[model samples]
Target: MIYLRRMDYTVIVYHLLFHLLLLTLGFSPAFCFFSSIKNTFKWGVQSVGNAVCSGVNCCDFHLNDNVEENLTKLLKDKLFGQHIAASLLVEALSSHRTHKSQKALGIGLHGWTGTGKNYVSEMIAESLYKQGMRSPLVHVFAGRASFPDGDEVKKYRKDLLTWIRGNVSDCGHTLFIFDECDKWPVGLIDVIKPFLDYHSVIEGVDYRNAIFLFLTNTGGSAIGQRMLDLHEEGVIRDKLKFEDFHDEISLSLFNEEGGFFKSDIIRGDGIDFHIPFLPLEERHVRKCAERQFELKGYSNPTGRMIEDVLKNMLYGPTSNPIFSMTGCKRVHSLVLSVIARLKLEL
Candidate 1:
């Protein structure tokens, strides 16, 4: 009995001495104990989540090879010159990461009429959805909305406000694609000023948790002119003043026109803006076109026709301008145009 009592007293003393030593070393006994327990729990949770997802959605992520390659290359841009659009997307999504706050990003995607900005934006949206992100995307069709019947500025602004409120009320974050931004009335633009600046109020909540992607066909020449007027003089941030360009519209002409015919300022206060252009590389264009055609039930087009299509659709370097409106319309009209005309089976 004396031996057992002595052993218990020794154990108690040892524990008390150990705790004192920890405290002397600037460690709290409770903190150490709780930290160890918390770490063990976290490790177990992570291990289980990884093990279960490894055979499911994790593997599905590996299926989109070409998309992976493209996105990987885009994300690797050091200067972010070639991947501005993708960078904005990453920023927008990062804002909504679990535990992150209600930040937002906006971008204005401007290019020529056939520059493929819409297609690129759609691809980015689909990629996010595939990655199991909860970000919601909406395609704003002005025709479908009762906005701006040529001059319905108030109605348009209201419609846009409603759309934004709907998204915020339904989800944590959203991607709003405002098409034909240049067509927005100046009055309506003023109405959306708060929203553009991430100061828009929805009910009692501040809507600073959305990404706005505005697409327009306005030229860079016009953008430069507008920037010169709006931005302070002699300010260079990466690119030059928006007005200078080597396109068919000369700088002098663009300045005289006050920018593009449909030009407007897209304030990206907390938003990312992208102006996606058609792919310059012939190989890239061919691959994209082939995939597009395949999806549209065109099994094959003759090598010559394919070349012609590329030339017309993408009139850049190493591409022929043979792709015209009539040709595109014809190809889109029939399901068996490839089998019948090209005599190639799908």
Candidate 2:
């Protein structure tokens, strides 16, 4: 037997203690050893211990446990207008997370620009993942940006399948967002139809835990017209229900000259919910402006400043300009300009 130096005993004790802490925190002994050994050898024990702890903290999955509570708070606090869309999204996600599902959850968000389709998607991402849209598990695709040409449908289809399969294989709980879906070439969306279907497993991957969101302005006109008709009929916008406009939005999606036009996804009921985002009124625009000012670091925006922001916005229906034409899409730039002008006045 060989004699041991005091320094050697110290190192051995430190190593055992470090791994003991990892084991107590639920890490496997093998995983702890693999994650820390290289660093320990290179940087000495103290630095390696800190590095291992930091790595473990940062690398864990970031999905929060109180999904419904967090999501409801985000929607109610930050989002303006579209009460029905807000409620439906929270309910759908809550129920999906709580129970076992047979098919991947599919939500199609249809609306005009700045009507909170993308904003709602971001809220959902934030609620589900600590990193929000930046999470590796969340994949976003734009139709015009990703698949611009009608002729390249075959190649796009093949690549799309491979990407979805690989991502789901890596993490079964994944989110796939397809923005501007209406701009994708016809018949292209059917490429992922098998994955979205009720199949228990597709090529050894169980996709039931995944979520797919399709955002489009395909049914904006019809939705806007329906809102106008409802307003004329004295129906309060907040009081409007999903059933009120679901059929109209569905018809537009089916007949429109876009991705979902007569697509099997629609005919086969692959899309679980076709959520319609309603047009914003003048009050809603004001709320957006106020929030924008706060975001731009102006906490207490005066009434004059808010009115100025509103005056710069274009609202419509030539006969009666009751609603914002561009929603709150241009609110950020508009707020900046207003702030600059106000500073000059001061």
Candidate 3:
């Protein structure tokens, strides 16, 4: 046998200790070492077993042809009412992904609370990223939770800009969602106006491949009035089109005291589509209840159970009570309570 040098013995001991440390930490020796190298180099590293996209030159950033089809399927299957919003979203996303866009696609969803605005946003996120909202590139910000005080608008603006710039620099296909836009401090959202503008590049980063979604309830009243008017005029709800409520909703958002109030994004054509979500009727709420039951594994929810769910929901316009006042927002909770009561009785 050949004699080994002291240096060789020391190297063997170090490697053995390193691998033992990896095993102690619950990582496979070979996988841990290669994964560390892959992360450091970030190129030409084939993922080991079941490795997900790390948001660095990964396939998750690439928009595929199936994204439109998948989005359309999800909207049609999962989302309840508001056909106008669904159609507009599908076309807008499809076009933006297929064509060469100059700026990030900015969509403003205006509606009443619990009218599927948040749900639609979630679906959009699911379609774009494999990990859905959990994806590193998909960022969600709620107004009330993110920026609570109006006094700190300046600080919020600085941090918001830095966050946007940094994320866009990392991945051009990032998706930024701002929920409860109505609650966001006025003039605070304009910090992102530059990212949403029609510029090919801002500073050194190109944000054209990104998507910005703004969800707000500021225009609920306007949308409700428009729908009521259309109903009185004998226009079928299914027949309602974008032109019918686009201008009304835009005016409401621009004049409202919330996020978009008197904002430059509204004054200019910064927002690409102001998709309106119509108030859900009783039938839509029933559908929501049915879906909730299906999701809860109660495949055959009885008619009486569904009726109980609807009875608990509040409807609107004390005179006519045409729409669900709270929409399907409380459906999940209501279903859970009903199921619990039924189990107790049984």
State the lDDT of candidate 1 residue by residue for 1-346, as single tens digits: 1122455446555655665676779997787566655655565566555454443334333223344444445455211222444554455454444334434556656644434555555655554444422222344543224344655656776876776766556543455666665554554544444554534455565656555666655454343343333334554333532233323223322233321232233322333334433222344455555554676676574576566455555232123332222222232323334335555533
- Compared with the true structure, all predictions reach lDDT values of 0.46, 0.85, 0.86
Clashing pairs in 2: none
Q: What TM-score would you give candidate 1 relative to the actual structure?
A: 0.51
Tens-digit lDDT string for candidate 2 (1-346): 2344567558766876887799889998788887567645654654444444331133345466788899899999888998988999998897777889988999999998998999999988898887788777789999889998899999999999999998888777789999999999999998878888899898799998899999999889898888898998999888999998988898898899999888898888888888989889989988999999999898899999898888988887776677798999988898999999988989
Once model 2 is optimally superposed onto the true structure by TM-score, how far is the C-alpha of residue 304 displaced, in angstroms?
A: 1.8
Rank by TM-score (best first) = 3, 2, 1
Look at candidate 3 and give me any clashing residue pairs.
Answer: none
TM-score of each: 0.51, 0.83, 0.85
